[model samples]
Target: MVQIKSSKYLDFLSQFGVGGAHPGGLSLTMEVLKNESIDETSHVLDVGCGTGQTAAYLTSRYDAKVTGIDIHPIMVEKAKKRMKKDQLPVEILQSSIENVPLQDAQFDLVLSESVLSFANASVALKEIYRLLKSGGRFIAIEMTINRPLDKTEETDLQQFYEFQSLLTEKDWIHLFEQTGFQHIHIHPQPSQQQDNAVLEDYHFSESIEPETFEVMEQHFEKVLKYQGILDYRIFTCTKG
Candidate 1:
């Protein structure tokens, strides 16, 4: 596990009223699910549902029943608060992606956003496969490496993103197939305007050190080279 040094890494969402994950949480989520024509009739399982952004949106926008799970207690608690604030009936739990506290085939859909890379991807895939109902849709926007990089390039990953063992597009497809997912659809995203002032404020002076800045730039460049490694990729799969 990568060292989670700052509890405030994502605290900007609550502090500054940003949508947090994926910036435009609800719209982005809907766009990702729209391909599958998901609606109020679906039951969603959100792996690593950070602050309940996607969960709240799913329930409110589509009237879907959503269950959100995360490994961090603080994140889970914040998600619960967000659900209550939005008047959504979302179930949030502090649990790992490898060992979710759910039964088999309980969900009509599964969603993950920029979270799976932190876990052992294979185990996470297996867990997602087990929890999803037959024909259930698994939709996600994840962080991934476009291709294998040299040690120097790999070392450019920031402390927070270091835990992410991003696999290539081929690896992603293989993992999905190996986990018993069928009819996989992958949509690659392109880089867009970046307004990282919030994150910059959080890091303050540390954000400008030459070495640190180089690493950060390299990270973004790598992501850009592969269409914003974490910013791109929407996948839909069916449980077999």
Candidate 2:
């Protein structure tokens, strides 16, 4: 495999046209949305929306007005194409979570699946808070460290995943509080050992860049190495 030197770990998944690039994937996303009271009048924002899978689902399932955003131009284009192909009325934009160009307090729901950890958590959370209407829900499924990582472990994770912080559950809660979120609830997910299966079943696009495979290899190695220490959690918070 050709070696790639990109620090943005998500670029690899994007290049391969991977949809639902998160723990539990689209199945978990569907399960979580089943509990949400979305309707045609509801406005939802999907942050770091890879290929617009969740956005399309929300639009088709709930008939909700959905907006999907990703920092990567390629991802945005792919998401737009996905919505177009599915005849979904979702808007796709290329933007960063820390600096979204949308109006403040406009969305009734903001969804982030495996997204916040890759960003400066504090700033990104504050932005999420700003974008949400009062009483709006911010739902995130993200990677969290089960215990404090040692220096070497931290370096490896940070370098491989481009993680801003491998925060523990408590650390995540504290940041949510500081960012003015209320009614916070966290549910830890059991680790499912299926990295190899996921890779094996991945539907690689014919146009996939060679560098993506190298990054995917690095991602797989780190995930296997840190399987014992890494965990994922779903957090639901309300904007006060």
Candidate 3:
């Protein structure tokens, strides 16, 4: 069996079996938003919108008009279903971060949480720059390595590393600057408290195939190592 990577992993994560947005890993994603101010009426683009949690939060908390895009079709479908269920007007699309299909300068707030690492970081940042109007804000909850890694460690974390094209914090900062962002800031956010109940519920869900369950079990161990390499950060950048 092929090991899950990129869009396939996202599709796996979107299912109820995985407890999509319940892991509270996105606490950092939420923290980044709390530190910034955005116009309620601004058109927002949520790149790599995993299951619509952040998009819904933006609409409910900031009243922003949200267009959420993800490479995973399953995620887009679930997000759309979630929005419809809540009577919220957010639009969800199945798309890629490397090649966003939206028109240029169409968004005022561009936000990505743990998403850009899944693509070419520089290219995604540049695409984000192109989409946002001047003076727009870009916020992300991302993994940033503290130092360069040895080849052994890199090989050990191949699946985790390949699933995300992670960069050191310095590299990410340089990319942000090069992409024409200003007033960049990065804040560390630790993982949320693990709820055994949530984990139990997730374990009991029917959508998880036996093979996927085994992969996720292995994946979690790798995630811990990856997070250790990169201090988890809530990075915010402003479009110039």
Question: Whose TM-score is greatest here?
Answer: 2
Model 1's C-alpha root-mean-square deviation from the true structure amounts to: 5.7
| CA-only RMSD, every prediction | 5.7, 4.2, 4.1
Model 1 lDDT vs. the true structure? 0.69
Model 3 misplacement above 4 A: 1-8, 17-27, 188-206
What TM-score should be assigned to candidate 1?
0.76
Per-residue lDDT of model 3, residues 1-240, tens digit only = 212245435545665523224334445455556766766778999887877877877898889899998876667777787789889999988777888778999888888777777788888898999999988888876766778878887666555446456578888888888888999986654555544453232213346566655566666777676676755466788887
Q: What TM-score would every model get versus the actual structure?
A: 0.76, 0.90, 0.84
Poorest 10 consecutive residues of model 2 by lDDT?
194-203
At residue 129, give the lDDT of candidate 2.
95
lDDT of 1 by residue, 25-94 (tens): 4555656666765677788888888777678777877888889987765576677877787778999888
Better of 1 and 3 by TM-score: 3
Model 2 segments more than 4 A misplaced: 1-8, 188-206
Query: What local distance difference test score does each model get?
Result: 0.69, 0.83, 0.71
How would you encode candidate 2's per-residue C-alpha lDDT over 16-47 as one tens digit per residue?
77888888877777777777789999999999
Q: What stretches of model 1 exceed 4 Å from their correct place? A: 1-20, 23-25, 188-231
Question: TM-score of the candidate numbered 2?
Answer: 0.90
Output candidate 3 Cα RMSD.
Answer: 4.1
